[model samples]
Target: MESLFHPTGNQHILDRIDKLTPIKLSEWGVMTVSQMMEHCKMPLQVVYGTKHIKVNPLIKLLFGRRAKKQFTSAHPFGKGMPTAKEFKVNFEPDFETAKRELKELVEKFSREGKEGIKVTDHPLFGKMTYEEIDVAQWKHLDHHLKQFGV
Candidate 1:
């Protein structure tokens, strides 16, 4: 699986992100390009200790392990999957600003590598290793980049 922790994969994702433009529209889903960029940043924020999500204990107990497996698997994320409310962008984001921030986060994620992740215990996915985080992050950004046809 391609991992953001590696230089090649990181550059690939950055190239795709650079292809995104203000006028680009999602091939599926409700989010505009800018909104998607903003949404993408949320998970990274959590990993970097800049954001927190409160998952219901019951939900975590019932679904956390299964969800973690799916997220870290080699298979790509399917379209129209349910998004966590915390990761959803309700307001419009500035296109250029969102793109810039997303790129910066992606770069930082790669540059710092596994040691950069500040939180390994996800609210809904339970405990994760650096490998799992890398796969999950790569899959997520790849999914969204593909969504925009970049």
Candidate 2:
């Protein structure tokens, strides 16, 4: 899997993000480009301890590992997958602001690399290693960027 920890993969993601514009429509899913950019930041924020998502205990126990495995695997995320409510952007976000913020976060994640992740236990994914986090993060950004047809 391409990892954000690697320079080339990181730059690829950043370049794809730059291709997004305010008027860009998703090839699939309901998020506008700006909203999708904002949504992308949520998982990274959780890694940095800047955001928290409360997962149902029962749900986590039942499906967390399986979901995590699938997410971090080489397979790309399918279109129109359900997201956690916390990651949903209900209000409009400024396009440039969201783009700038997402790029900044991506850069920060690349700079700090695995050691930067403050949380190893994902609420919905149970325990995760640094390698898993890198794959999951890259996959997520790739999936959303593909959504915008970038």
Candidate 3:
């Protein structure tokens, strides 16, 4: 797993993020550029603070399996999984503002690093390691960025 704090990984991910434009359109996903920006927010919300959704047993049983495997491996997310309800942005988002927010959050996550971390319940995945969290984070953004043909 790439450490969120590692210079190479952090810089590389940030570079991809830096390339986003307000007018960017996805070649695949339904989300617009701003929606993609908001989608990026979900992982930041998980890391920077509390994830509002509590872990339920059944959800943990199903989504958790794929989530665990996702983190443990470098494999990119394939299309098909249901998008989280909260992350489904519907309103028009300020493009420049969203870009600014995305860049800042990635920087903050990198600076924080993985140290003495505790497992947190994901909306889908049950519990995730700090390493898993970092990899999951990078891969997710990478997937969407590629979706937008970035």
Clash count list over all predictions: 0, 0, 0
Top model number, lDDT: 1
Model 2 residue-pair collision total: 0
What C-alpha root-mean-square deviation, in Å, does candidate 1 show against the real structure?
0.7
Task: Tell me which residue pairs clash in candidate 1.
Answer: none
Off by over 4 Å in 1: none
Each candidate's lDDT (Cα)? 0.93, 0.91, 0.74
> Model 2: how far is 28 from its true place, Å?
0.7
lDDT of 1 at 137: 90
Looking at candidate 2, what is the lDDT of residue 148? 86
lDDT of 2 by residue, 43-135 (tens): 999998999889999999998988998888999888878988889999899999999999999988789887789999999998899999999
- Residues 56-149 of candidate 3 have per-residue lDDT tens digits of 6787787779767965687778865567676778888888888888888777777766642333556676667676777788878778888877
Q: Relative to the unseen true structure, what is the C-alpha lDDT of residue 93 in candidate 3, on a scale of 0 to 100?
A: 86
- Between 1 and 3, whose lDDT is larger? 1
Candidates arranged by lDDT, highest first: 1, 2, 3
Write the residue-wise lDDT of candidate 1 on 1-150 in tens digits: 777888888999999999998999899999999999999999999999899889999999999999999899988999999999889999999999999999999998889987789999999998899889888999999999999998
Candidate 2 segments exceeding 4 Å error: none
Model 1 backbone overlap count:
0
